[model samples]
Target: MQAHAVIDHITGWLKDYHATAHSKGFVVGVSGGVDSAVVSILAARTGLPTLLLEMPIRQKEDQRERALAHIEDLKQRFPNVKAISVDLTPSFNTFAETVEVDESEYPAKQLALANARSRLRMMTLYYYGQLNGFLVTGTGNKVEDFGVGFFTKYGDGGVDISPIGDLLKTQVYELAAELEVIESIQKAQPTDGLWDTDRTDEQQMGATYPELEWAMSVHGWNRPEDFEGRQREVLEIYTRLNQAMQHKINPIPVCEIPLKLLNGS
Candidate 1:
């Protein structure tokens, strides 16, 4: 991957898009993850007003610290970069209380609430974006956004534009290194940061990003029988997720009415 060229292209694309949309700047949710770090820097590189929001809903201490550090680093490096720290714990708690479910369905309820956290952040990002006439930028990388469909629909998936959606997980790290992203975030484990428990993306997905990447590349033609042990296991994991997440991966379905039915006498 031509890291420097890719950076230039993405930075140029951002500026052009901003001009085309007639927007003032970009707004990104900084989660202390490599993908978000890379995106924030890229947006900052455009020399346009960029707002980095740290909306924490009971976020982990390390994660929150990393986000704060990155935001501060960018603010120091770029004059146009601004930072906002919004604590959404109270908002999330209220919403959770309003939608409380029975203990019998605790497992399902937990998943729903986790996803709600993401949706709340999405709303917060848009609030700032609209307030400042800036585009809401997504931090999802290709592997999570497209390959496995690991992101939450209409939640983390809700954004005006996904600048790094075309790059794989490993490639995102490459870009992060090239862009001089903070060492802590670059070396930290990749996570969705949606659950209360310290669960990394690999733990939830049952496979590492590298394993999933290989499976995604060859799943169309490769069969489990051709591989052995871990390879077969990873392939199965990837295939199952890729199939189960099709709804998130594909465009929303719309029903089309027949012209004759509409014009019926």
Candidate 2:
């Protein structure tokens, strides 16, 4: 991809969108991942009042350091940029304490809590967004947002505009390099940081972004029978996830009343 062109296009698009929305600026949750790093820079490039939020809930040290470093870097480079760190660990603990679950439902409870972490961050971002008239800028990429539906519904998926949602994971790294994103973040493994353990996205998803990208490309046009070995495995993983996450990928279902019923026919 033409990195420079894409960056310029996104920056301009953000500026135009902000003006149209009549909002004060952009608000982004910086997670020290490549996706968020690229997006925060793009938002800063617009020269609007961009707020970078570092809301950590039991975050790892390395991740926290990288996030702070990126925030400082942006503050130094852009006068319109403001950074804040809100520790949500206590809040999360309290929430966990209040919720009750059976031992048999351990797996579901763990997954629910993980998703709740994302939702907590989302709520924090919007809290500041409303306070500052800033739009909640999303940092999701094409692969996560559309390919496999890897994001949490109404959680990290909540946002006013997704500046980098069109770019693939590889393209996101390309843009990160072009934008001079901090070396630490660019080098770190891609993670959602929702769980306590530092599990990389690949480990959790059972497929690398590049592998998933290939599957996404030929999902409809090709079938698993056409491939062999690991190719088939990756395709199956992609297909299964895509099918399971349709609720997140598609619009919410709404039941419409029949016209005859409404007319009392």
RMSD of each: 1.0, 0.9
Residue-wise lDDT of candidate 2 within 1-265, one digit each (tens)?
Answer: 8999999999999999999999999999999899999999999999989999999999998999999999999999999999989999999999999996885957698889999999999999999999999999999999999989989988999999999999899999999999999999989999999999878999999999999999999998988888999999999999999999889978788999999999999
Per-residue alpha-carbon lDDT of model 1 for 104-212, expressed as tens digits? 9676888899899999999999999999999999999888888788888999899999899999999999999999999999999998899999999999999999999
In order, what lDDT does every prediction score? 0.93, 0.94
Measured against the true structure, the TM-scores of the candidates, in listed sequence, are 0.98, 0.98
Q: List candidate 1 segments past 4 Å from native.
A: none
lDDT of 1 at 70: 98
Cα misplacement distance, residue 219 of candidate 1 (Å):
1.3
- Candidate 1 TM-score to native: 0.98
Which 10 successive residues of model 2 have the least lDDT summed? 100-109
Clashes of 2: 0
